[model samples]
Target: MKHSITMLEKTALAICIFIALIAAAQPELMTEHIQPVVQDILSFLGSGFFLFVNFLLFAVIILSFSPLGGRKIGGEHAKIEYSNFGWFAMLFAAGMGSGLVFWGVAEPALHFMNPPLKQSLYPDRLASSLALTLVNWGAHAWALYAVFGLVLGGLTQYSGNSGDICAPVMSAFGNKLSLRKKRGVVFTIKLIAVFAVFFGVVGTIANSTLLISKGVEIELGITSPLLIGTVIVSVLFVTYTLSAKLGLRRGVQSLSIFNVLLAFSLLIWLLFIVPVAPIMKIALDGTGYYLQLLATGTWQFDSQLNTSTWATHWTYNYYFWWLAWGPFVGVFLANISQGRKVWQFILAVVGIPTCVTIIWFSVFSGAAIEWDKLNQAGILSAIKHDYTQGLFVFFSQLGWQGTILIWSSLLLLLVFVATSADSAILVIRQLVQNQFKNESTLYVWCLALFMCSFALLLQQDEPLNRSIAILGALPFLAVFILQLAGFLKEFVRDLCA
Candidate 1:
């Protein structure tokens, strides 16, 4: 146990390096051969994959209003550590900020043009764009998170133990195990959990750097976008490292609050500046349409308005991506969520973020869809030609080319990335730390994470990164399901008593 974190790092690092080496040596084989294998695996997971996550969300909804929802995650008398606002800021930034920015402008446009579905249900290009986009970003994603965070927080508060993923499982099933057996179980869970978080963050950092590169080119007109991107990520790594060093309350919380405000400022501007009628109309209609088709499992197979290919690429991939991100996001949520009731945590974790995405997609995607309709600035062509630069291009088209708008956006992205990586660093250290006593483990893992992400950015093998990221979630997903089951069992017993 003393050197468990070191051992975990060695194990995870070896696997990551081994995979990277194989992908590096034969990039084509990896892309051509390995990627299809991954796609096949995802296809095998299929509707079951979609259903499992959706069911988790549904389960959370049922529980949130029951007696379970009134139960406090921490002690009944514990004081809240972070304000609801700050807590939400961290959760949103860490959980889905980068995804929102990347997909916000691009997805609606793509769906508008290609209309991923073969059926005519949502075939109206401009009208249903927000609906198509929101389904992915909305309640389903947050539902997974709320459960994980609640369980983690529950174990921590109930037992006066700072719990890891294995805690709930142990609480449920390890009661008969000897001390040695429990340690073994925890050691094993940490090994997989650490790697899953690593892959997810590295993939996100790599993809986010692409967005930063485009932002630099669009905002500052710098020539070497790649180099600029590297610098930007490096700076973010340094910033988050220091933030991690400050611990949760001071470092991560401050950054989260700032980024949420920054991102919201942009959302407000776009929503207000853009015509009110279309944005409101698209959001209202799209929401109803999305809710109506909630059970269709449109992500599973070929449908009238969509193709199986579209589901495989978007919905299936996102399911894994969100799951992969669970540990990083869950740990952060658990840490900051003390003193909150289960229902409040659910509301904070599931409801607020979902609503934010609805508004965000409504404003951003709605505006882009309107522009595509008007062809006022050829918005569709801009996004089609270069999706990474979509947000910048949208800004340019809207005549918000002022440095204040552009530079502030660049800052907003940076801070969001920083808060995410920083919060994950804090959690990863706790996961891999030596019985939760190791300090140097935090710095070592933090730097190692950014370096891995930096190395992947250099490789620029997005498909491989994305494929492995998707795969990383599979093991973790199995573990989380067990944890959820374990949590429910223990809670029921408590309720009965």
Candidate 2:
């Protein structure tokens, strides 16, 4: 099979590399100057972000029950390519990534120590902290992916377009432009997609590896961030690159299944040991708080509670992070979800993984809270010092079993990181090459991604790394709105037909 390249692909690749170059050379510029501007922009757009995501969640639910929901993605006769288990596993692994593991213990503890709500009872604060964590990781985040995936799948399978990021953009307005102008638009959007994905994944890599390096030190007593980061990045690059080479079925699918099982095994073990009553209580109450606040309070940044910037720092940052990942995950989901009905796609994408998230966070955070109540270990203090240490600190309270659990978590975290990087490499190839063809360039691209991530690790400042990630994702806000419009236009056309 011959793989042909175009100027569009070249331009996109060039722009991606240039962004990485900027990050590597002028980290201060991004952190010092660009960070404040980006934060303010995100603040201004906060309400819009909340409202859009809320719309997506409700829209997906309504669409799942409406007449359009009955439509099959690749037509009525197309058969499913992946088993239900495989489908769920891959989508969950690809979308959630290591952030779930990285934040499982830390986020809840952080929120508990400094919760958004100022005036609340002790138990209410606990439940509300977990609820806020859920708000970040739960339905709203997945709904963005759910709706975007539906649109991408409809276009790729039903509208006869290639799996390029620009397909939806082109479909939305391509008819109004000339051939030369259309090519320019396609080139521009693909460039933005590549930039968004590269920076977003780089941030993930920096953060996950920071955690993994600390995990290595905990297990093996290797204290050098440089050595640990180098080894982890090298291993991650090789592993994911090999997986990409093996393609989706043999590589990604198998890894995703194993990841989900491993993660759940950890969750189940925690469930058995943690105070079951508290776990259940937090899960129930947290979920209630999440739903109750879904519309009214999820996006609020209260001034009286000294949380005026809390929403800006955490919630808005997360929204942009999800938006940045939307195109990559959307493309990956649409590709795998070829034969499912609209409602099936919506439910599976938005429902199953979200339930898993709520449960995962509840069990882990509930356990941390229970232990903290006893002062078994300074879990909150550890998290306050370095968010990566929360998982290990919480594990330390488990006695002899702590060793085994921490090691198991280390393995799971590594695989989670690998799966994320692997899928990202595959997606970048598809976007740049305009197809899913495997070639030498895939390896080169993987190495480039590693370079970008490695530069972030070299910075060695968590807050700075996070700011860069947010900055990188900022441009995609406009792109997401464009894609949303394109999707609705296409959906309405299909309804009319």
The clash count for each model shown is 8, 0
Q: What is the alpha-carbon lDDT of model 2 when measured against the actual structure?
A: 0.80
Maximum-TM-score candidate: 2
How high is the CA lDDT of each candidate model?
A: 0.74, 0.80
Error in Å for residue 380 of model 1: 0.7
lDDT per residue as tens, model 1, 1-497 = 33444676667666766665655465576567767887887877856877777778888888788876777766576678777788777788888887787677788788777776544576555556666676678888888878778777754333434345777878677468899988888787887787778778777877878777887887777888669868977897889889999988899888888888889888776766667788888778877777766666444435534456666767778778888888877777777787788888888888888888888887887887776677667777877887776777777766644355667777877787788788877777778656556666667667676666666676665556677676678778777877877777766666666
Error of 2 at 332 (Å): 0.5
Clashing pairs in 2: none
> Which 10-residue window in model 1 sums to the lowest lDDT?
155-164
Model 1 error, position 436 (Å): 5.8
All candidates: TM-score:
0.91, 0.94
Q: For residues 402-432, what per-residue lDDT tens digits would candidate 2 score against the true structure?
A: 8888988888988887888888888877877
